[model samples]
Target: MPPDSDGVPNKTRRDFLKKSSFLTAAAFVPVTVVNAAVNQWDEKLASVFEKTSLHLEVNGLALNLSVEPRTTLLDLLREQLNLTGTKKGCDRGQCGACTVHADGMRINSCLSLAVTNEGKKITTIEGLSKGQELHPMQEAFIKHDGFQCGYCTPGQIMSAVALIKEGHAGSEMEIREYMSGNICRCGAYPNIVNAIQEVKTGGLS
Candidate 1:
């Protein structure tokens, strides 16, 4: 022990020796053991926060991807897979601009999680066409001028295709009701309905 300025003993030397010995022992530990401990901790954390695998078919192409749990189907399509045809109008799933076909059913991709769509067949606007030939609905839209700015055309076409397939496009009123979810800011509702009606009457789908 050492005396302070007042001649009173401070901490004893045994305490200092004990701390020094502990530090020295810690310093002498093997680097391999330290690295192993760190690796074990990292692996434990990785196991808890591991990314999930999603296997699905997109636009006729089979894909096996790893995605975080929070990744939405719209983001996975537009961002990860580079499929930009599916527009991201209202990411809250209101405007229906991110519509896509999943397992033959029309789905709001913005609201569907990528993980939930595992093993499902996804079809976007790009998948509607075969090679260089345009789908009949595409041709009908072009003929009827169903869009102005074309921002919502992809979602509209996707929904129209699904509506025709599901036998919901029986009349103009039915088309309007089914397509009400897709909001075209350009106000091309009449032309869009005409295009869908023509395709439905012609049995082009």
Candidate 2:
């Protein structure tokens, strides 16, 4: 204790302690509120349940599954069925590495929701080949050395399969424009175009 004026005891420590405690509590108010809100949000999000069954024909096999609502079709294919042919390059819809045919239409599998694909047919690269026989596009790609690293080959093949079905194989420039989504970082564009043309023109063995 310190002596105050006129020999009275001063309450400097007590006053300082009281003011410090009040300031500390006031400063912690917003932090505590924010923490509480964050905890509530996490609890709410965790409480949401989404276990729904999905049925689809994947790679020529009928699959019945119970998946979470937020699961992607790409994840189901790659993570669940172990069909890693469809590479996960960007996971975003921008890159065409995860391209697959959903009911004969090319779509980014990573962007496709699993629940949305229920009862639909999905054609992956694994489904393109018959027993002991390669599809024409696969044969052509191998003949022309169309891919170097081959990560994008499956997507390219799937797209080419659909492209041929859609009758977009009229010319070289047309093929290039149609196949532009599937990128070959090894600069195998010329070979890829030749492969597509070969398959279209009966040049593939």
Candidate 3:
């Protein structure tokens, strides 16, 4: 009954007793009820929320898509658009196997959220060719045997194209430094570098 600093009756013991009683009651609740409540809450959220609409162009095709906010560009391309040439190697942006071009700049699609790329242009490996005519970089890679196992070819090609566009393919050292993000486990670094050099020198605009 004693008043505390807030000029209210001290209810510490009362609060503790109330909490204890509630907890004791909760302890007797069946696990099924708790699980059902959680499931119902999740279902309600899903039913109430709407998927985000993303307007973007991929491989010269304008796409209007509905996706969850959590969807990544990699998933949008590979899972939804069926552009599986962009390999999901590490999926952490470390191996660079999921690399793609967003608005003419190289990016790790795996780490880039699809919602963030709304209204942007995306280019995957599948976009690099026109009918039977391959992009110069793609041709160079094939000629140079730039990949073995071929898991990282897509990312390596994308990065290489961007490297030449960015004017970073001046030398072998520079190419290696810039293209270091794309890792090839097949020990084809030399061939990869050669392919990039050929493309750079070939003047492919």
Evaluated at residue 141, the lDDT of candidate 3 is 85
- How would you order the candidates by lDDT, starting with the best? 1, 3, 2
Q: Which clashing pairs does model 3 show?
A: none
What's model 2's lDDT at 150? 90
lDDT of each: 0.85, 0.81, 0.85
Q: After superposition, how far is residue 47 of candidate 1 from its true place, in Å?
A: 10
TM-score of each: 0.76, 0.76, 0.79
TM-score of 1: 0.76
What's the CA error at residue 77 for candidate 2, in Å? 0.3
Top-TM-score structure, candidate number: 3
lDDT (10s digit) by residue, model 2, range 1-205: 2235786654354455544544554577877546645565433433233266789999788988877767898998999889999889889877688999998899999998888898999999988889889988999999889899898889888888888878998999999889888887888889988888888887754
lDDT of 3 by residue, 1-205 (tens): 2237887744465455444544554577776446645565434444334367789999999999888878899998999999999999888989999999999999999999899998999999999999999999988888889988999999999999999999999999999999999999998999999989987777443
In model 1, the Cα lDDT at residue 183 comes to 93
Residue-level lDDT tens digits of model 1 in 36-57: 4556543443434446788989
Backbone Cα, N, C clashes tallied per candidate: 0, 0, 0
